[model samples]
Each structure stands twice: as C-alpha cells, then as structure tokens.
Target: MLFSFSLPFFLSLFSAAQQGPAAAPARVQPSAKIEWRPDRPLTWEDFRSRPATDQLAALTSSSIDAKVGCVDYVFSAQVRAVFVPTESWVRDPKRATPQLLRHEQVHFDLTEVHARLLRQKLSLVKLDCEKLQPAFNNITKMAFLTWQREEARYDQETNHGLNLPRQQAWEQQTQQRLQQLEAFALK
Candidate 1:
C-alpha cells in the first residue's frame, strides 16, 4: 500500500517536471513615442525667426557649451547633421537621412535636460563660481562624450550595422555617471 501510494506521487511529480516550470508572464516593453511638433519638419526659416539669445540659451541650457554672446552660437537649420571624418569609414556621409536628424534632436533634447538639472543642483547647493566650476566642467565633458556616442550610433543605424551592443553599453555608462553626478550634486 505504501509503495502504491509513493508510485502515484512519483508519477505525478515526473509528469509535472516534464511539463517544465510555469511560463513567465509576458513582458511588455514600453514604447518610445516621439511627438514631432512641426508637420513640415524643421526648416532654416524656423531657426532664423528665433532670437539668437533664445537659441543660445536653449543650446547652453541643454548641457551643451555654446558661448551665448558669440555670433557662431546662432542656430542654423542649414546645419542638418554632424559628421566626423574618423567615423566616416563606418558611415556614409551622403546619407543625410531624416533619422539622422531625429538622432541629433535627441542629443539636443538630452543636452537641455542635463543643463537644467545642473543649474537646479547648482542653485540648491548655493554654489559659487569657485565651487561650481569643476562640476560644470565635468558635466560639459559628459555631454560631449554622450554626443560622440549618439553620433556614432547615428552612423551605425544609417549604415545598417548592429549598434545594439554599443547603444546598451552607452546607456549603462550614462546612467551610472548620471547617478554618480546626482549624488555628488545633492550632497
């Protein structure tokens, strides 16, 4: 009787084992929905109508370094894309695709967010030039590094090369650095 009872238990266990572990609940990835405000797309005229000061402010505030007072700081829609000869071998320069524009726009937007956060931190900490200068320099460096990464990704995507690895590495590094900076700034 004991053997008979144990046999059924073993058989049930074996059957369950054959069925394998319960399936993991399906995971839904969040969608990245980018809303394009201008239906006509960004144009040279659109850039020119904006005040130079406002344009500089936008760029500077985005965590990008642009001398606001300088004439070169002006935004020009004509400058649709950025290219580096060193990475040209990996990407085609002739491919001035809309996706490239969108990629640059992401950089621009990220710069703005970084700049705003830095300023807020500076104010919160009551930092003077002497104290804030180093932090400012570090943030600038980080922005440039991020810019380079995005540019490389643009090239990779445009050339039909796999950039997932590079993108993931960048995302990890950026998140780590941002967290470190936030911690220091908060203190």
Candidate 2:
C-alpha cells in the first residue's frame, strides 16, 4: 500500500472552527488539497501541519488519485496529482530554506509526472469491462511502485535537498519529464 497522508479525523477537528455544527456528521471534512500546476509552486506557508519528527527537515504529502468508470461498455479513467498541505509539515519553519522548499516542490512535480504516466497508460487500455478493474489495478500498482522508488532515489541522491548540485540536476530532469508528458497533463 502507498504511504498515504490523509488524516480526516484530525482535519475535521482542525477545521471545526471554520465549519459550524451544521456540518454533516457522516461526512468527513476533506483536507486541504493543492493540485499540481506549473505556475504554482510550494512554499513554507503551504506546510500547515505540525512537525511529527525532528529527524526530517520537511515532509511533502503527494499522491495521484485515479478513477475509472464505464458507460455503454466504454471505459475511461481520470487521474489527478495532488499535494495535501494539512498533512505536510516542516520540522522548523524558521530553519526551512528555499532549497528545501524547491525539493518538496520537485516531489509534487514527480507525482504529477506519475499521474500523467498513469493517465497515458489508462488511455491505451482496451474497453473490456470484464478485465477493466484488474487491468486498472495492475497498471496503478506498477505506477505506484515505480513512483515510490524514484522518490527514494531522488531523496538519496540529493540528500533531501542538502546537495545543491544534485538537486538542480533532478529539478532539470523533472522539468523535462513534465514537458514530455505535457500531452497527458490534467486539463
């Protein structure tokens, strides 16, 4: 299973002040989600959650949400890359540097690249309802595994944004990948 950052219970309480008692009891308040965009980059202010550990400078909670549907035997899927601010946090805001923020942003960007890849793969799937769910599951599982591996490799190579040269190289490569997958970007 993917490492998810969603915390609906705490989020509901955190947002209780903003939402009155009239809020639906059965429905969990959705946490803050920011869709990946070329123009919008992450910042220290975007890290809203309290730090959970001193071991890491920062944590970026990003994932790709994929949905599939079938109508009249035609199957389709929609994929979105999202960053959850409520679940992302920094060990020390004052200590958080621009380089660190850029690194976190790259993580989100990588999620987008993976989302695009999932979308591209889903687009090519044959319209067979009998096999659609299994196909979707297999494709998404592979993508998620690949995404996690890439993330680990990036963090290791850049040393969590401490290595400026490696960080820059990753940033450049990520940008190129985003451009290459521009055709599959969320509309």
Q: Residue by residue across 9-127, what tens digits does model 1's lDDT show?
A: 00000000011222222222223112222122221111212223321111111223222111233211110111111111102223333333333334333333343444344335432
lDDT (10s digit) by residue, model 2, range 82-154: 8788888766665455666677888888888888998888787674776666666777788888888888888
lDDT of 1 at 53: 33
List candidate 2 segments past 4 Å from native: 1-30
**Which portions of model 1 show Cα errors greater than 4 Å?**
1-63, 66-95, 128-187
Backbone clash count, each prediction separately: 2, 0
The lDDT for every candidate, in the order shown, is 0.29, 0.70
Most accurate candidate by lDDT = 2
Query: Local error of candidate 2 at 121, Å?
Result: 0.7
TM-score of 2: 0.82
